[model samples]
Target chain A: MSANVKQKRTLLEWVRGYTGQKYITTVLFLLIPIVLLTLFTLIPAVNMVIFSFQERDQLGVNPKWIGLDNYVTLFTDPTYLSTFKNCIYYFFGSFIQLALALLIATILCSKIKFGNLFKGILFFPYMMNGVAVSLIFRRFFQKGDGITNSEGTLNTILALFGLDPVKWLSTPGLVNVCLVFASIWRYIGFDIIMFIGAIQSISPDVYEAADLDGANGWQRFWYIVFPSIRSIVALQLVLAIKGAASVFEIPYIITGGRNDTSTFVIKTIDTAFVYKKVGLGSAMAIVLLLIILIITGIQKLCFRERK
Target chain B: MAENKHYFDLKDYTFKETPKSVRILFQVLKYAFLVVCCLVVIIPLIIVLFGSLKTHDEYIQSNVFALPAVPQFSNYVTAFNQGNVLRGLFNTMIILVISCFGTIITGTMTAFVVQRFNMMFTKVVKAIFLIVALLPSISMQVTVFQIVNKLGLYDNMAAPIIMYIGTDIIAIQIFIQFLDNISVSLDESAILDGCSYPRVYWSIILPMLRPAIATVLVIKFVGIYNDFYTAQLYMPSPKNAVVSTALYTFVGPYGAKWEIIFAGIIICIIPTLVIFLALQKSIYSNLVSGSVKE
Candidate 1:
């Protein structure tokens, strides 16, 4: 009891004498997140880099050092090559997503009645779970038993127009489009919300000034609003590229990456878990990471050059 | 004499100069566009709601967009039992509460130190965080899963909670931005009054941080609640299933029954929808400001 009391008193004196209360508290405050970040993100990132270079069995046991072999296979394999190609479709899809969002954001930001109501309704989908969205859209896009017996909502609509029901999820050509459409449905609102936020940040006085100059709606958007939110657009572009390349959950749940809908991330998950090619999966992940980094870098360069 | 008697009104002059027909046409077009977009957004959700209310036979027989003749509320009862939705909700709530609190505490504390201190270590810490923020976390999942497994946290609630709290860069950014707006005089004055650092934080700063706290809490709550990928990966067991995973598995046995699946989806989404409706204004404003400043 005496030793414990003495140690406590000495510790108190040490805190008071050398570091001061402010410094000690700062240390205490920063400790948790710093530690957690290191353990979760930083260390894992390094481990991932190392794992990519080493070969491991399906169960991720008995690692053998094989330098660049995984990466070689990733580049040469036709299946993996197609997965990379699929990312291009998503990249294009993101463009549509951004355009649609921008259109909605600009229109909503204008002097319109029930703008808040419209915003609320449109942004609601952004909060839904990915799994729920997949199910809903799957039902919406499901193929019917026959042309006359259309089951999916889209096919029913097509039938209402007297057109033959299209194979929404079955055809190889249309399946990726269907999945991308689902993605657009699920995430367009999020982009709209972000774009709306960016648009709202522009001062109204600028719009009024442009209005006085007889700059029509399109001119005003091009000159004042678009330029002001260019940084956000660039940021969103980077995010779009990243999101497209890493597109998972939707395709994974909706099609299980079948019908040529497999993306880079889905393929990686399949490799690691299903095929038990841990090293190869890690390599694919690294390749995807590098692709994202390079794209973001290129985007940065383009933005800088335009400036 | 009548023209002289009535002063020319600005509204009347504008309406007379520009054809009201054109203006009305523009108004109609604008509303038409908005309504079309609104329909596009709402129709799918409506279909799901209507589909959920239909009996299995009705769902299979009727058109996809057709309304139910008699709404079958029993589907929800069946969904609740078969989907294990109550258990899912209970488990998800445990994750949501713990992770939200954990994120707020860690994010605020770290932001406080990083924003307040001028020490070299703090700068290094900030730089490290920024770098990690830019890195694609999806790429590191292989190692992350291994790490979780090695830590013996797999198949436990703690796995997702830890991941959620540890990986949140947005909350940290928001807190730091909030701290920048708060004057340091409050801290200095409290210190002068013999308040310890921790005491100053609790008494002077925390209450002042109410708005930021609310924003972070709401964002994190929605994020953790809706997350399926992490939950699916870490918690593989059915007994420990959260809402998304539970719904995924529930679909297996009831694969042919779209009504039951729709019911489960509705149940899964209702809580978020209700909370969103109740807090629309604050949530919208907070989200706007959060994205803008970032």
Candidate 2:
């Protein structure tokens, strides 16, 4: 009887050891990722807010505590304010992109021939390197001498039509237009893909019913498809708007933000890296973050209410 | 089928309610629009291809759409030699391999531990990950720059690798979703057979996660390969240039030679084009799944 009791105690200890080991395993597995996140993402996020408050010449140089000045400058300064206004061009452009994507997605889902081929060709550009695409467009929109303008592809086409070679890059009025076009070309494919998925998910019974009821294609699309994909549309719009506010690579590479074409992000990067105004740059970043956060918060509220 | 036969099975009906002329017009319009869109997308690529093969004077004097008199394949050689294309590709490959593997391991381990354990700490961790996903990564990059510099990892490949591995929320989400489908009985039975938790995870749980891993691998590979901002910012030196940044050598404030730049662009585009063609189907499905999950 004593031996049985001892065996029970030993078994209890073994089970206890097993539980303890599992706990250790959990901690061990989580330890590196958590530490990395804290070091990289979490700390930087908090420090960004902190840096927005302090005035620093460089990133970590001699710093003076100047609360709200950087933010004040960010808000009141005309140079910075103009960049935020520049997003309007992209904001408007995104609506056009979404509309086009929706139209094409509807067509593609309607048993169209060569649908896969069309999609593959259209989406190929999205997979290319951003810098390379920017380079391609840079050559594509180059200004050419009117008499023998043979280099710029767009200009060459214009020349073919007996039209004058317009300065696509140098003109301030047209530069933003050109930038918006590039943004659309790179992103419309993504919007198309998303819309196609949403459209395909709609049940066929609804379409069948619409057909049997003598409804035309337009009526079917208007009453059924559009309303069904409203959530996806809303989500894509939110993302596109968010993307508009942070338009960076295309302008940064194509025009290098010259000729009043700087977006908010390019301005932020220039302020920090080029001008060495780390504090002001941090404040600009915070403002950008606030804009994005507000947008996402609104989206969450809209989604919750619908539910 | 018999019940629906009397109800007029509209699903199999070959006829549409729309008028014939309207249907024809719609079909014509759809084809016209698709053909035009496809041309608009393909024409630029064609221009690049043609321009890449032309001599310098041919590129300048001839129309952008004109065929080169001689297909100057040497332009590619010039681009490869002068642009440091090989080194850029090699550096990008290194970064891609290390970061992708690191992400998979860390992401899977975190998912396994969180899903297996019903602890408060795990719940908080999950919440933090979700919130971080909502946070805009670009806005916080200002401070990230400073931190990396402070860590003395400036201009090093390790900087981007670590950031890529750490900042991935999508992989964790994918893994967690995948883990939910996996039966806990596998782990339990192994445990009952004297298998330790880590052993069960390594031997059983890891093998079951192959599909999720492939999805993450493709997404992460394409993202890391095509990334310009991080590589351009972190790995700025010519020796450390990535495929994206390597093309930057040909173009800048000063005017560039269009032919060589075109050659470099083509050189950079080939790898991704090949990968896309090879994994086209999986990529489309994976992207849709990832976005829907998000």
Top candidate by TM-score: 2
Give the DockQ-based CAPRI class for model 2: acceptable
Which pairs clash in the backbone of model 1?
Answer: none
Tens digit of per-residue lDDT, candidate 1, span A99-187: 98987787776667798899888888888888899998888888777332337888888888999888888898689888888888888
lDDT of 2 by residue, B1-294 (tens): 322212122112224655667657766777899999998888888999999999877877888889999899988998888878888899999999999999999999999998888888898998899888866676577788878898999999899999999999889999998898999999889989989888988999999999888889977987898888888777889988999888887785214577888898999999999998998888877777666666
Given candidate 2, what's the lDDT at residue B142? 76
| DockQ of every candidate | 0.39, 0.46
**Candidate 1 structure quality by residue, lDDT tens digits, B56-165:** 77887889888899999999999998788878988999999999889988888888888877788888888887667766666577778888888899899999999899
Interface RMSD for each predicted structure: 7.0, 5.0
Give the DockQ-based CAPRI class for model 1.
Answer: acceptable
Q: Lowest lDDT 10-mer window, candidate 1 chain A?
A: A142-151
